[model samples]
Target chain A: MAYRENEAEAHDEEHHEHHIMSPKVLIGTWLGLMVLTGLTVGAIKVDFGAQANLIVAMAIAGAKAMLVCLIFMHLWFDQKYNVMIFFGSVIFVVLFISITFIDTKRNEPFRDAYDATNKPTPEGRVLVEPTVSPISTSGSDAAAQPGELKVPEHQKPKVPWPSQLPDTPRVAPTAH
Target chain B: MSEAAIDADAAHEDDDHGHHDEPFLGHHFKDHDHQFNTGKLGIWLFLGQELLFFGGLFCAYAIYRGMHPEIFVEGHHFLDVNLGAINTCVLLFSSLTAAWSVRMAQLGNKKGLMLMIALTIACAFGFLGIKYIEYSHKFHEGILWGQLFAPSPEAMEHAMHGVEANSRLHIFFSIYFVMTGLHGIHVIGGIIAYAWLLKRAAAGHFGPNYYGPVDFIALYWHLVDLVWIFLFPLLYLIH
Candidate 1:
């Protein structure tokens, strides 16, 4: 019991080293984040060209993210391992994004070609045919008027139907 | 030894080890520091995974924007920048309170911790409320994703001013809804976490020696804020 009490006292002494962020730092970080937020919003007003504007917005956002991770999340006062883990994840994310961008950039020509060849229907133009059945099988004269299928020009099937295909020669029967 | 004798010995051993005395400390951990460090490491790993999860959406946004910069240029005009900015401020304030709550827990100030936690919860709800307004406005305007991308005539006028609506505008809204929807889900998760913390705190469950839960949840709340830090600029402030 006495030994446990002594250990507890030592633990108490060690506990003082545990870092607790000050309110001053927290408030300052908050204020900085707010100012950065304002800057991001305000940046949209200026004509920095599209790419330059995106870069400026991202830069400010990156700063705010750093502040949140370092201070709000206490990575600054945290163990080195924690910091490494967080940053390693960020690096992986960057790699993932960049690789995806590279792949997409390489495929841009294909995508453009596809888009050009198969243009989507114009706005408010529904390409799907109405759901009601258009064919009639009754022998009556009026029923002989097979309903015309209003298939969209682009959506019409390219291959002929089985009934429309040329007949093939019959094979000889095989011995059982 | 007999069973009763073994049980007695185990009880005495626990008494000597002082595990029972510290109700909050886990029996398996060597000490408070061990438990706290382990919990912190676990949360950090989860956060790392979370980054990658959100990273996928960001990659989609990058690819789509790269291909259709015009869509983004037109799409962003439909989003309410003022509401987005207000929500950003709200989240930032909530993050401050969350961090402060951790400090409060560390300092063993129950009232301060409770106050900060409550404030953080309030701010989170405020953010979601503003988000609700934005989403409803979009829904009403028919500015939606995929096949549902038919913008009302007025919405089209508002978005384009005079330019024709891009057919691929739905792609932008798709990215927008997926990203913001995921973030809003995280906010809801944070609210649930904070509520749990609040309940434990009301029962006087946290203090300097056992504030790991508070700290872990605060880290999570900050991460949600971190995601929004990038999201606000990417989705709302597009050029």
Candidate 2:
């Protein structure tokens, strides 16, 4: 037992040293991370047009995450197997997001149809299709005009409110 | 007190076989490198799984944010950017110290290792402290998750300012709570791990031949920071 122990101890002494990441490298990585963080925050201020802004922010963040993985986590110098494992997770995450987006897009037309069927139109009031022309409501006009309260064209008393039509009895359609 | 006594002391020291008595080395491993390398591989696998776990949440955030882009744009205004930035710095600095601790252990600088571990723990606590303030502010403002969401006057004002106060705004706060809450739990776990490492370091269990625990824990700490690196921009830096 003593002899075996001495051999193991000799092995331990022989392999005691490891690749110690230098303090300079670590501090440099931290500085790089901080700078990337600042860039992300600053990118938000740049008018990158809505979608582009989000893209830029995500890009900066991705850069920061990569730095942490490569330097601080030691994957840059560590075994290739470990890097493979980490990137595998990242790749799976991207796949998950991509699948979800595809499904959402696939169902979008059905969602629009559902909305059209369920949307309620008030009695006697045709839903005005939106137009490029400016729509000024008489209410705002009346509020603005102190002396004259001109009735809006839609609210004129000459138009009769639509009376409720009698409920028509109908047979239920048979299932084919 | 005589010359013979000194000679006997020297003879005893020689008989002990200096640097060969490592009580910490387990019998199964051939040497320290084998044990350390094995531990490192195991930790990498565990960290990979951790990434997958959090990846699910990130996917959820992505889907919802894509669906209700306006909700996120409006809801993010409630979160204070300065606090998030400060916490990010704290976690990054802690990661630095955590990495340093591993180096110290490898160099057999017990004092430096212990001090770095302690600093890492302190920084972890500071992170939780800031997170607590942020969470409480959210709670007090009634920006809660799901059914518990009751927007305070301030939150209501912000919501009314845009997107017509869709109840789906609750989804943003829900994601916020779930993601940051999980990360907070990770931070707490990190604190506990660092504290345990500090005790072991104080007991002189770690050194050049057996610093696997320090290295593994530092790797874990860096992962926590890495996750936050993404979370900070996604949640708090919304344009």
Q: What is the lDDT of residue A88 in candidate 1?
A: 97
Best by lDDT: 1
| Predicted complexes: DockQ each | 0.33, 0.28
Q: List the residue pairs that clash in candidate 1.
A: none
> Top model by DockQ, which number?
1
Who wins the TM-score comparison? 1
Instruction: Write down the lDDT of every candidate, Cα atoms only.
Output: 0.83, 0.78
DockQ of 1: 0.33
Q: By how many angstroms RMSD does model 2 differ from the true structure? A: 14.9
lDDT of 1 by residue, B160-214 (tens): 8988877778888989999999999999999999999999999999998899999
lDDT per residue for candidate 2 within B1-239, as digits (tens), equals 99999899777755653334767766556577667767888999899899989989998998888777888887788888999999999999999999899899989999999999999999999999999999887888888997677777767776466445654577888999999999999999999999899999999999888899999999999999989988998899887
lDDT of candidate 2 over A1-176, digit per residue (tens): 57445535645543223778888998998899888878888889889888898899888888888888887777776656677888998898889889988787654433433333333332211232212112223454312444333344443333221121244433322210
